[model samples]
Structures are given as C-alpha cells and as structure tokens.
Target: METPIDRIKLSQTAKDQLLKLRRNTKIDQWNILCRWAFCRSLAEPTSPSPVPIPQDSNVEMTWRVFGGEMSDIFLLALKQRCYNDGFPTDKETLATQFRLHLHRGIGYLAGDPNIKKIEDLVELATKKI
Candidate 1:
C-alpha cells in the first residue's frame, strides 16, 4: 500500500515533548515515541482539531523509519480513521490529519501526569479507555 506521507517533520514543541518523554520513559528513539503518540491520538473519541503545526524542529523521519515494521498497519489505521471521521482518504487529507493527530497525541502524552516511567506507559496502554 502506498503511504499518504513520505516524510514527517515535527514542530519544536513536539520535539521538546518527546525529549521529556525520553527522560521519563527511558525510550531514546524518536520513532518509537512517535508511534506511541500516533496511537494515543487515534484512540481518542474525537478528531484532532485542525490546527496549524509548524515544522520548525530539526527532528524529521521517513514514514518507514517512523512506522518501522508496522508501516502498513499505521497507514491502514490512518485511512480507517479518516473514513470514520467523514474525511476523504486522499493523500493530502491523510497527510494533514496525520500531522494533526501526531501533534495532538504528543501533547496528550507529554501533559499526562501519570506517565512517570516506562511501566506507566504500559499501564496507560492497558488501561480501559
């Protein structure tokens, strides 16, 4: 399957948030943290607000790097999300929503007070939503 986005560039805010998450969770890879953030946002009941996020940070990754072995699954989930949200699944829309969801999810994770360690992250993933 063709991915809607080829490259992802995060905002400075997201970069900072991921840095904090790194310290808290001891997970060093940006791609791993990004995967978590993307899934976290997707789990939300409402669509992410269509806000503009500046790609001002130097942090960048290819879709393959970001998704690793789960690239196709991530793309499928994104397409399904667009369909469920009543949005077109065109590449442009998918890319836009991907950015919005990613940023929102990063913010959600960074702001959560309970995520103090890697186990907290696991607990969060296992918790009833």
Candidate 2:
C-alpha cells in the first residue's frame, strides 16, 4: 500500500500529536488499521449498496442499513457470547471457545481430513505411485 501524502505535511503540530498518541497507546495502532483495509478490500465501488438512505444519517448508519460485516460482526458476536458466559477471556477460555468454532470452521475452510497421520499419507501415496 502507498503512504498517503498528508496535506497538512510534517508540521510540528502533526509530529507532536503522533508522539502523544504513541506514548498513550500500548499496542501497535498500525495492525488495527490493517483491519479497516482488509474490510474495504472485500467490496468494489462499482457495486453500490443495495439500499440507499437519507442524507442526514452517518457512515456507520449507512453500513448498518445496507451492508454486511463478516469480520467485525463475528468478533462482536464472539465478545457478546463471552460476556454472557462470564468467561475471563484468557488463553484457556479462548482456546475452548476457538475449538468449538475451529472444528466447524475448518471443515468448511479445508476439505475433510480422510487420514489422521503422516504414515497413512505415505502409505496411500506409495500405493498410488
């Protein structure tokens, strides 16, 4: 991705603002930015939203009215379930939650695993060859 030129340029005010943000923030803010990029990467400008809305409503409302959020919605649902279940959201709890989804999600993302072991794979390949 190209670095967008700031019309404000490298003014002292911009530099100071960035320094303040860095000191206050714990995590790298750049990775969070990638999520916005990933979401935008999905759709094209040519394919407009099916439902149009009034001029007054904001962009967030615009998305809520006409668009679907695959990633953000999944995360929001995940947190909501965690909230209801009273889980601490630590490694163990997350692992258990992940297992429930992973088992099903993997089946859809990857083809069904017929063989369980590398030995089985080698045996099958040798027989075929």
> Which candidate number would show the highest TM-score if scored against the true structure?
1
In the predicted model 2, the residue pairs found to clash are: none
Candidate 2, 5-105: lDDT as tens digits: 11111223323332343343322342222222222222122211223222231112121221134544634544445455666555455434423432222
Q: In model 1, how large is the Cα lDDT of residue 89?
A: 97
List model 1 lDDT by residue over 81-123, tens digit each: 9999999999999999999999999999999999999999899
Question: What lDDT would each prediction earn against the true structure?
Answer: 0.96, 0.31
List runs of model 1 lying over 4 Å from the truth: none
- Report how far residue 61 has shifted in candidate 1, in Å: 0.1
Worst 10 residues of 2 by lDDT: 1-10
How does each model score on TM-score?
0.98, 0.24
